[model samples]
Target chain A: MALNVNVLREEFPILHQEVNNKPLIYLDSAASSQKPRAVMQAMDHYYETANANVHRGAHTLGDRATQSYEAVRDTVATFINAKSRQEIIWTKGTTEAMNLLASGLSQSWQAGDEVIVSRMEHHANIVPWQMAAERTGAIVKVLEINDKGELRMEQLDELISERTKVIAIGHVSNVLGTINPVKEIIAKAKAKGIVTIIDGAQAVPHFKVDVQDLDCDFYAFSSHKLFGPTGLGVLYGKQARLEALPPYQGGGEMIERVSFEGTTFNKLPYKFEAGTPAIAEVVGLGAAIKYLESQDRSAIEAHEQALLKRAEELAADIPGLRVIGEASNKVPVLSFVMDGLHPSDLGTLLDQQGIGIRTGHHCAMPLMEAFKVPGTARASFAFYNTLEEVEALFAGLAKIQRMFT
Target chain B: MSLPNLETFKNNPYGTETAIDDVLENFEFLDDWEERYSYIIDLGKSLPEFPESEKIEANYVHGCQSQVWLIHMQDPADGKIYLMIDSDAIIVKGLAAVVLCILNAKTASEITNTDVEAIFEQMDLIRHISPTRGNGLRSMIELVKSIASQQ
Candidate 1:
């Protein structure tokens, strides 16, 4: 299956706008992808026709809404190839999803139990675990990355021991785009009877994910990065583990039998969903999943690979432009710093041309400390992005260099 | 006609597109950063309708180029929220005017649905700012939404 770039471009309405009298060149998909017409239409259709609340009503619209809402669970279940739809719990994106596990796992973990996380994790994955470790008196062990931004697997192995209760890592780094070996890491963790949680926020949108295949204890991702609406994501947990854990929130939907005496929680997914979920966003997420399935993902990956190669080739010759995270396995994220120009300054110049890219620490401060820079300019890619945009970005960077000089 | 100048969006009482030509025409007339700085400061002086009493801690924007205070009041007569903004930086104050135009006198949904990038194009606003300042603008908008979503 090959990606049809032109056809895919047509689906995203925002791609045609002009910026600074020039066509807008968007290269910040890592932050968030633009929604296609299908996703937009699905969200619109839901609001227009099926605006009723899900799972608590007896009316026809309610039934339809509930079915559509639950259909997304099945979609997510299949999307990640989870063992069952029961394992897919809707969250307020990956941040909340990771926090849920951090807080939830803290209940069972003892003070001396260790939790291992990578230095490359976004603040979302890191901070919650840090808080959890602080609250529970558990040890927080950080795995260091090499200069090229690849996680030192030998160092990682040395850190994970019997005392290590959980290993938290990102599948693909948000800043460096270093695709971590989560499957291998999970296998090792499982061998040691340790729980593993993978932050799939950066990975799930770019590649196909199969939770069962990876055998990870928990997997999380956000909908916004996958060309869907914000405020929606999934926390995929194995059924046994999910059933064993206590509910994160005490609310209307999650309770099955509530009495003055005691409360019995609902099943796997609803037990986790304590309040009214982001229904519209979830519907939009389903539309996004459908849109992605319609496309040829293998082709998307290949196109992105070609773009990454081109970006690397063009940037390699620049005297001061040193690409960060030169890992063997990486996605199409290019984080770089030039000698004379600050990354922030370069980003400002690039924006003058309406070239949208992200700069600063990318919410990975420790990783920035490791690199010994304030920050790097990051240009992330999605399937909708094109080679022309890449060229325009470089052209903008060149113009920026000349202006600064 | 040439596109709107940085000063046009800077000192306006509202974000209405006026004095675009005068600012753009005279943009290059100023030679150094000192004159440009004064020009930007003058632009800040033209900021409109800021309610000073509303500059409380509740409305302060995080991760901004300057300390910006924002207050949103829902008008009982028409369900629209009136946003009054102030910032420590003169340029930031002018930038706040740019944000207020589309955001002020609008419903919560309107603020959320507004195509900020489109507004930036119409005003040629985003092309001139630093990236951190741009992100700061985004952060201000996000803060607005966070408040609006609750309301």
Candidate 2:
């Protein structure tokens, strides 16, 4: 069946609400996606019917909650083709997930050990590694990006070596939407026997992620970005790699046994997941996955691609508007700078039209520094966004452009 | 030509922890941009006490639109971090205040260990601010943590 997203849009009641006396045109999915009714109803249902802690309870509610939570893990494992549910660890979001790996892996890294990242990484990916490098004598080597925001793979190959212990990269640039050749990046790292971590926060929602195909040692993404709930994310690690790393936190559930002297760690995924998990959100995520599975994946992609093209065409025609990243391979994310207006000023004006677009560095300040601009106004797309919405954005931009010019 | 009076700008408690949600649930309740600007600046005015000496170059927050100073004083007895903050911009000062209440007076370990998510949830802070302003607030929290780590 051909899935019409507008039919699904009615499910999200928030979408219908007017902002600033105008209808809401949400264009910031890269930051966080709007939850469909299916996702929302699933979350509400969990709270209403089966709000109980998972795995530890002996009651009927616990069993049901545990089932719902594990079902999402199964969905995630299958979605990414992970070897087992043991490979999936729940986290607060992508940032915490990345930090989990960083905290767990830092003890193994020596001062001279090399970690590779790119200039285009969100602060979440960059700062954790920087912290880890600071603790150990490890050195963080950044792979440069061209003006189009494409990762310099040749530069990456030169950077990785015998001393290189980890290659941390974003699967898709959050600011630019440039899809990195992570498979190629992983293959190069694998040749050196180095571990690879993919920040899939921007990639997994927009594109299909087959972790088995990519062969990345660790992959992390937020559930909210993939039309799921906030405060929940997934970190997929190869079982062996997870087993090798130390426990990220000293907490209730992550331990097999604890004594006055020392603590024994639990099995693979549980070792990383400490304390209470986001049970309702995980159930909501399972529903979100089920909802996405029910849709035609290619159709969604095609719709977004069309929107990107329309956005590009309209954006380019604006007299003073310059689209920031012009790469051949990109998602529908567009960052732009107008002739004279500050990004904040532009954002405020756009809010008046009830069109929401993120302004500033998009948390990739180094990329902004590389581009030699203060910041760009970023508008990202999801499957639900339409060409008409893109037109509204351009119309809004034209007003700002006229004012500035 | 008459310009709007800056002093008359009152900070409504709406997105902050203290906002009267029922009375002014939406931004549109305010008549014009001038009123909203005044309200936001007024929100900045509510920022808690920041030590004057802490205003030195060392305490300056890097990414803010205004000059912001932060000083972390450790209470020798309890080992909690006492934060005093100030900012040149009214809105930023308000932002600093909101941050101080959530973070200040907590132990270094508490500051390090607390789940910021819960505090943000209680404050209902993120949804109301401009995305950039929200990011700046996060940066301020990060700066606070960086200080606590040093302490």
Candidate 3:
């Protein structure tokens, strides 16, 4: 089933505008995806009519807002195929969720306990654990990646010792686009009683993800990367884990009862969500998920893969252009570094031609260090990205090659 | 592999020499951003060639969108600083050239007194540049000022 890329492109109004007198070709979706009309309209509708502080007011607007907001919990639960709606917690983004989990978990970990992470994790995943280790005296063990950008599964046994407390990693490398073998890694962690966390920020946008199927203790992703608004992400914890972990924050709506002497916390999900949430963005996320559900996901994936292949084929012809990662199973993220040109130069020149691509360490400095480059120019695709857009990017790269080299 | 040859660059063959007034007047004449952008890239074509040895880690400046390096020396005779800066990215190299042209060969007291940010703002380049690049630009200026203050 072929998706009509033209009709899909029409759904995102921002994509149609001319940027430097040329049509906009956005390849920076990995940083944050552009919202479609459905998502924007849903947020607009929420603000226009159902604006109210949720779960507290008894008025008509309040009731509407509360119901709409709570319903999205169910949407998120189903979207990730979690066990229950109560397991889904609203967070600022993947960064916040990881920080919350690390802070909460480190309190229980003893000195010298090990927390395992990979070299390919985004700074969001790495920093939190480092902070936690700094505070708790717990040790952090890093799993190295091979030259091919795949995790060295052979070294996992040595890294995971009896004192291992947690194993946190990305489901897909933001820089490499390699789909990690999380299920296998999670199973190994589970056998040793180490808690597992999957940073699904890059993976959720491109393919099907089932938290239950993966059996990860906690799975997190940002909504903006999935064609929704910013300032919100979903953290899916197994029900028991949520119940066991202490509240990451203290404020209104997260408490069951408060007295001068003592305050008891609220139930699951609410315990982690403190104060008035990003209500409109949550509504927008629900609409984004609904919009995704309407599309044939497999067809979208196939379309994206085609774009990746086209980009890679073009890269092969460019004399000094080196495509960074070549994983067997991957998303539509193509990163490269030309011999004479810097990634930043490539990114700047591409932007002049009205193409948007991300060029830098991608907040994955360790991965950049591991790859032995300052940064890479990455072109990440969403389902709606057209082959013509890929062609436009190639043309921009060619122009950059002509002028700089 | 390197920027323009300084000998040829100083000759002003293209009249693309980035004098403060020349930069201002040219930017003023170019009404549209597309034209202004190509001109900025053109500005990069005049930066002096950078040596491979000076590209070491100690001279490297962090927080830039590009890999930037700055190396400087005080001229014993004039009591002025001679600054050499480079970047892997062409636009940033151009930006470095712009900064170097304004501040090079100036005494520490003179550098501490001049408001370079105002000059860039006067050019209306602030709004066009990315935030990270803005930080990079400021960082370069900060490095120069700190070096001046130490003197």
**Predicted structure with the largest DockQ when compared to the true one:** 3
Q: Model 1 in CAPRI terms: which quality?
A: incorrect
Query: How many collisions per candidate?
Result: 1, 4, 0
lDDT of candidate 2 over A1-405, digit per residue (tens): 445778867767778989878999999999999988889898888888887888877898888888888888999999889999999999999999889888888887877999999999999999999999999989999999887889877797689778999999999999998989999999988987999999999998887899999999999999999999999999999999998998888888899999999889889788988898889999989988888887788888888888999999998798778888888999889998887555655676677789999887788889999999878889999988878999999998786555433
lDDT of 3 by residue, A1-405 (tens): 898999998899999898767788999999999988999999899899999999987799999999889999999999989889999999999999999999998989888999999999999999999999999899889999988889999999989999999999999999999999999999999999899999999999999999989999999999999999999999999999989999999999899999999999999989999999999999999999999989999999999999999988888888888888888878999989998787877877787788999988899998999889988999999988998989888877887777754
lDDT of 3 by residue, B23-94 (tens): 777778987645665676677776666677778888888754676788777767677776777777777777
Tens-digit lDDT track of model 1 for B20-44: 4445455558764335434544565
Better of 1 and 2 by lDDT: 1
Native-referenced Cα lDDT, model 3: 0.86
Candidate 3 residues lying further than 4 Å off, grouped into runs, are B1-18, B22-46, B49-60, B71-81, B106-135, B142-151
TM-score of each: 0.77, 0.77, 0.90
Better of 1 and 3 by lDDT: 3
* RMSD value for candidate 1: 10.5
Candidate 1 Cα misplacement greater than 4 A, ranges: B1-151
Off by over 4 Å in 2: A1-3, B1-151
